[model samples]
Target chain A: MSEEHAVPAARLRTRGLHLAYGDASIIEDMNLCFPDAQVTAIVGPNGCGKSTLLAGLARLHAPRGGAVLLDGKDIHRLPTREVARRVALLPQDTQAPEGMTVSELIRFGRQPHQGWLRQWSDEDRDIVAHALAVADLQQLAQRSLDSMSGGQRQRAWIAMAIAQQTPLLLLDEPTSALDLGHQLEVFELIRRQAHTGTTVIMVVHDLASACRFADNLVAMHAGRVIAQGPPDRIITPELIRELYGVECTLLADPVTGTPILAGVRRA
Target chain B: MTNAGSTRAGLGVTFCGAGIALAIVCLASLLIGAGNTGADLALATLLGQSSNEEARFVVYELRLPRMLMGLAAGAALGVAGALLQAVTRNPLAEPGLLGVSAGSGLAVAIAIALGSSATTLRISVAQLGALAGCLCVLAAARTRGVGSDPIRLVLAGAAFSGLLFALTSLLLLLDQRTADEIRFWLVGSIAGRSMDQVTAILPSMALAAVLILLVIRSLAALALGERTAVGLGHRPELVRLTVVVAVALLVGATTAVAGPIAFIGLVVPFAARALAGSDIRRALWLCLPLGPLTVIGADILSRVVVQPSELPLGVLTAMLGAPVLVAVVRANRLPSL
Candidate 1:
């Protein structure tokens, strides 16, 4: 996206990142960079630490070994609010108080920019309106999120991240609980945002969908990246077999010219 | 579950209507007192057909101050309850249940046992104790994963309150005279209170007002949960700190003035949430008016129901507040915050 926009890119780099829970190490010396304005999908099996890697990037999880640097400074060194302003993260499972409207949930995306004195501003209003419209949530804004269908609620949550207006937004399994249509709806929203120059990093289980939607894919296995690059290069059958421990054939999606996983039986 | 919007409006209008009813009860209050100086002569004096000196003393001097204290005490409990419930995001989270009042009560009991004859000083001590209790509970709630379980927090609160209350009872038992002095007060009644206690508590009440204003925004953010609250740039620690201080001050002041009234906080906030929807800010805002209304109204009920002898305000509040608590627990099934 930055290559097309011609704006100078600020790299998000994780150098020698190590994470552990008590005694067990989850990630070890993981050095990687999320290229600016690119939709990078971290794909792996359950407990492979793709979500953990995403959490480190969003500053939600503190690193045990090295630094997650946005530009040159360590993200942990920044104030939580400042990191929030620059990097917005949507955790896989988010909840709101009962009776909260869709609009109210999305408006919280403006949290980083809002303070007591500057509670209501024209800029905030515009951003909230735009987010709702972009997510096709305007008609449902006034409706209570708990009362809505799962797909509608997911869209509302996505709308909230969109409203944050940060260049770098990370989503952890945004499509985890959705049906096929709902997953496509969420994926399309991610794709559209990426097209508009926002850096969307998501953890996805579906490699085919990631290949179709993500501009770049970082395939992982056992807390390490197996490959990182464009889907056509990274989604090869050899890489897929290594990442998932399954044998599968990969071919071009005739429609989008993206890598398509044609057949899959567990190895 | 009750629709918080229409429920609040209904309660507001009902509580307001009850306020008018409270005025009539206040007149009944003016008509009677513990003073031996009054009888039917006070009634004629109040009606303006007669002005017996003894009747005037009974009505103006004795009954008026007691009536005023009841109103203030009830309002304080109600507001404190509403604040606790909103801030904690637990409908069952009343200050009394959380040991905030017991903390205050324990301090006053200790003060009484210490041979402190100074009433004004005991007020401050009670407030300090309430603040300590609030801090302990908040710390417990925020540490790591403990805050995640709402029911566990409520249970912790109940245990904390029971411990403090038990300690207070022990302190009272150590000194017979102090025990006699504190027994009715501990049970919570506005009987025999002087205007001096009311004057002593006004400033803390004012401070509580200001503190509530400052944290209302953060509490609203908190309703979205902690990470979201941090994401909004409002420090969750600061918000919790401010709320604890405000609740402590309010609970302390009411304890000082009324001697540890229970259930007004639980019921008032419960009712307010039923009316104002789930927005913490909106609930807090509505609680201001609703708190005093519920308290004063309850006080009036305490007066008329017993008629000749009169019941303790705390007893009535407990009776009303407990059923509301049962309803709240049953209403959500999941015990929603």
Candidate 2:
């Protein structure tokens, strides 16, 4: 709760965004505002369209009826590279070419800012170095991604996103496959990134971790936002039952004072 | 930071070493041959020391042009292989194996069957065939289950190649007058080909080179999966289309001159990736040298192996490349691109 707050600006927002895969509508008439320089987590159960919304926000998925606005203009209408400069996304399935060093992978983040004639500038080098440091991966810069452990590999991926230096970062289940320690390693890194005034939006699977890490939570079910606010204000037994069909007691973290779900049972 | 610098320096050293090796191979290609002229005589002729007329003719007219063609064809096939593998994200995706070479070969066979002997027209026909083949391979790669499985995609390509080769053979059977020419060309050799044929395809190769330079960075981004590439501000569709066209041009040009040399495309990029790792930019640089080295080395071996009757350049490359292909497939795991 002691994290310093920046003047929040809703640079990214959806106006009646409708997304579908052919005839199957995933997210319909979705309206949401993602606060700048803050960490917001989208948490929902299976088939809830959280990832679809993330894709729409990142412009990977086109809106069916409405629009995703970036800085008051339709995101789809802006030049791709121009949108890329302002937003970066780390999708759930991240794979790098074999034998790619951490630094080489991170250097890809600077592609948007580079051109055919202007490659590997001093500025690009500096930003990559800064990203490595920020992700605590300086020592592993030359190490291949395949050689690293799970936590270190995830950090390297995060470092690549950091090197983009975009104001908004969206991650889909960044800690999905990692162990608890590695999960913390990534969550802390995301927190540090948010502290530096980058808007961090991620689709998190674990409600407890989402409550602990995200400043705001958007809970969804069947392509609808059932609840949206701070975790402490929006989380309740009824909301938990609605989202996951589980009834649980909400407890408080002893030190951080964040909401923690305990004693859960199937509704 | 220092580690990165050291790696960069190491790459430079490796690149220079490959370049020197390619130069040696080029020299060997020029020196050793199936004729009466020996390496010493060819060297003397090259240095303008001896006026041996036979050595001069063999070196200048026969060996020199063949070596140049080998270099150009080798580089093109090597680069084409690397580009194909990178874009398809499949290590086994090769010009020869994936029907691209066969595509061009069939085009030329069709041309030869129709009684067309013009060199420029043949090159254009071959390129057009290569473009078609390239599109077919990409289409197979985009299919639901086939695209995700590298081996399945290769299987599809092999089937397509077999069909094309059968069609080419059928054409040869139907046309007896063009049969000898088509048969000789079908075996794939660089002997007796002139410098003019090599020069004819230069414009297309040059254009392909320009396209590659433009998309090299984007292609590298593509190796990280499509969504990530899109997230990085690159148009993955555009990059894929450009790479397919570039691969077609390179493979088509090489086939036009070399009669569908196989396995150099596969082996050269494999070795380059081994030496330079998987970064396409670095692997591509190594491919430039390694490709020519492999082709020229094979060409030299082909000359000395059979003496009076030289081995076909295509046959020699297949002999060399097939084992590497087996080795790669037999490895514990196919290295993911």
Candidate 3:
């Protein structure tokens, strides 16, 4: 391709990444790049390494080989505080101490920017307030997380990540165990975040929703990426069968034109 | 933001209230004692008036040292307890129950057996033992099933403490002549400790205070779990180790001067959290005054409850702390560590 026609490089890239728990290797020789300002979903069945890959990217799990690059440098080598300022991760399950108000929980996100010499500042306060507003938690800011509903609690957690004000956001099943309505609520927030020019990457269990919400979809099976592209182009009946070992048909959503899974049965 | 600012101000007010309570309790500790010299006489002596020799001696020599000892020991135990609970993420975690104090007791017992009577060396030896004990509890918590579950960690601690207690008893049986010296360390008390003993432990307490200030922020972040703490630019393992060292120093210093006063760590942290929410940072701030307040209150109560002969300060704290422990476990939901 001509130089001008070449696509810009992704903000986050994995160069032959390898990960393992003890002696059992999970992801091996994986190379992928998640472009900036897009919602990228990593979808797979059980025993796949989607969540593990995300953990490696977030530096929660160190890779055994190669590197995870943020912008153009190796992320592992960067100072921890600098890395936190550039990326934020929200695992599937998170907890706050008892009786901690929503505002208090969100305030913890400013830890990277805070020190003994410099505690609370106007910018920190403004960002935390902005995070609460974006998460629709302005009214519940004073309420304790324990008193909130499942949906509200989840939103509060996302608000904490939002308060970090990172350009890259990573979530592991951000809506798991929530009802359909709550799922949509969280996904809408994630979508809004992505629309604001943040690169949002999430490990999504539901392929249909992943296709519906994400700008790009990465499909993995048995620790390797099998397909990746725009959801409309990457998702197919054969790909679903290969990933899940189930017979299924793919259909386009009437309203959004995103790929949707229809009839399915055991193969 | 305005609401948050107000909430913070409310916390500041709570801390001030606790400080005032501490001052009142310290005065009470100075004024009241189990002796012929009454509170009126002690107050007269404190007011710079010419009082009888007995009253001046009682307030200056006896009550003054004891109250100062209570303040230092109380603050140490309370802060140590809070640090243990925060690092383990178990509200029930206490130095006394987790064998830290028992560890100090055993070390002192060994020291007495070895004929090391120097007060300064005893403090160091006790602190070293307490460090070992803190490490043991942490090791137990790190074991697979025990680390994550609060009750299981407590159970492991209880078991470890029982082992240390048994070893200490064995040391007592082996050395009969040193029984008098070891007896005081076993059943902790604030009485009869000279100013020299208090001075000896002050250095360790100061060191612990510095360490706590350094790690308190990271300990708060750890409440969100280890991964979240790491994600926030904190080194979770390093924070946990620093907390353990700080706990060992505090517990050792307290045990050195006042014996292994039971439950001050547990009760102090419990009360601090109650008065100032669950954040370790806030709880620790409250712990400063609340520890001395609770310890001195218990010390005064120990003197008054049994006239002519004071109860061991450790005994009173245990009586007050055990119920709170049960109440915490039975409260349907234990506060997240």
Candidate 4:
């Protein structure tokens, strides 16, 4: 638990955001607000525009009409480096150069904060160390990324985002390829990050895990937000059916008292 | 902390070792040549102990200029290869292999065919042609399915290079005077090129060096993938464009001087990465010295192997580089960047 410099959590929202790929419109007139310092998961069926929305929020995609706002200002209006200092993104399917170590990958997080004359400083080094510790990757810092397991590799990437030291972090399918144990490992780490007053927004594929882990769940259907609220208030059979065309029984987890989908199948 | 420190030390040692080797190779280049002047005489003349005018002329006027040309061209080609490979995120994205050299060669051949004899004008024409070649290969790579497959990109470049080579040969055939003037130059040699020609390319090389420094960090971020590089606040498009221009300047200037020397760009950077891992920053540092070392060493061997009649520098590099290219292709996996 190294003492990271205290920064105010950033508020992110979309104001009638319209996203498209060339001539095809994906998300049209979408309005949403991401609560500060919370784990918010955007869950939807495939091609429902959840990932596209995340990319828009991360400023990786430009809006076809409207804009994404950070705090009180339009994100697109700010300098790219300034936005990077406030928001960090972990893109899906990242491939680092072969033989790059965990520490080496994490050091790149400091690039936005660095300049030609001022490359490595004490602060950069400290932040990288803290990120490694936060991701539980301190022991594996020197190991090449290609030599690591999938779980460790994922953690290494997450550690890089953490090293960026941004108040808002956006991840696309953070746990899509992980096994149950690895998923839990990553989710728990995300929870810890959110608890530290960093805003965490992720696009998740699993409804069960999304309901279990997210403080707030946003369900999308056909390029629109179908339902959104705390998992307990929003995890209904009807919502489940609308999302996946599947019917599922809901149960309460005894330990955490969160909603859990059971006996799921197509309707 | 200790591991990182040790790795940094290792890189420093490698850099120093390469520098020393480059110096030795440079000295060898100055001493050895296809002439009556022997190494002992050259050494004596260098030490100012001998007044032999033939040794002085051979060492100072001929071999010195040739070595300088080798050093500059070698470094430019090596850096160009490293930059292209890093930007493309493909190990096979070599300037020579990807037709950049051939593009410049074709441009020079066309200029010579049109009776353009000015070396300065030739350098600019060569650079413009190299830029066009770079854009063509990269544009082809970016089309639909080719970008994802590194081999396909190389194949396209090979095809493009073959077409350019055919065009150059056609030009040579149409003009016998052009053929007589360019026959030896087209084979790629540093022999008999004057000091003025080497100095002509220095400004462009210096410019390329500065551009490389400005984008080195961004280029490393680029290796993490495009989206990631963008998220890191780097303009991937800008970084890529800068790299292409830098590659054009380096490869173009070198090709203008050395007549399309192949494989120094491929082999030098390949060896640099093998020694320094895949980080372009470290690999680039190694490339600086290794480029000169490889070129000058090959140049020395070319001079000594066939006595009285020297081999073309391009032929020697091609003979040495083709095996490396084959090894890269035959590897278990094409180590991405």
State the lDDT of candidate 3 residue by residue for B1-337, as single tens digits. Answer: 1222126787788888888989999999999989998988788899978559989988988989999999898889989999999888888889998889989888988998999888888888889999999999898888888877888888887888899889888888888878877887678888887888888888898899899889888899999878787778888888999999999999987887788888888888888887778888888988889998998999999999999999988899899888988888898777786
Highest lDDT against the true fold, candidate? 2
- A1-267: candidate 1 lDDT, tens digit per residue: 113243335568788999777888889998777778889899988889898898788776778889898877898888877877877777776777777788878878887787667786889889999999999988887788788878888889888888888888888889988899999898898888888888888999888888888878888889988777778776777777777778887788889988888778687
lDDT of 1 by residue, B141-169 (tens): 76556466666777888899989988988
lDDT for B94 (candidate 3): 91
Who is ahead in lDDT, 1 or 4? 4
Query: Which of the numbered candidates is closest to the native, going by highest DockQ?
Result: 2
**Model 3 over residues A69-152: C-alpha lDDT tens digits?**
998788899988899888988887687888888998999899888998899899999999999999999998989888888889
After superposition, the stretches of candidate 2 with alpha carbons farther than 4 Å from their true spots are: A1-8, B1-6
Write down the TM-score of every candidate.
0.87, 0.97, 0.97, 0.97
**What order do candidates take by DockQ, descending?**
2, 4, 3, 1
Off by over 4 Å in 1: A1-8, B1-76, B139-152
DockQ of each model vs. true complex: 0.38, 0.60, 0.51, 0.56
- Please provide, for model 4 over B4-102, each residue's C-alpha lDDT reduced to its tens digit, 9 standing for 90 to 100: 212788899888999999999999888888899999999999999999999999999999999999899889989999898888777888888899988
Let me know the TM-score candidate 3 reaches against the reference structure. Answer: 0.97
- DockQ for model 2 equals 0.60
Span of 10 residues, lowest total lDDT, candidate 4 chain B? B1-10
Query: What TM value does the first chain of each candidate achieve?
Result: 0.94, 0.96, 0.96, 0.94
In candidate 3, which residue ranges exceed 4 Å CA deviation? A1-7, B1-6
| Backbone clash count for every predicted candidate, in the order shown | 5, 0, 1, 0
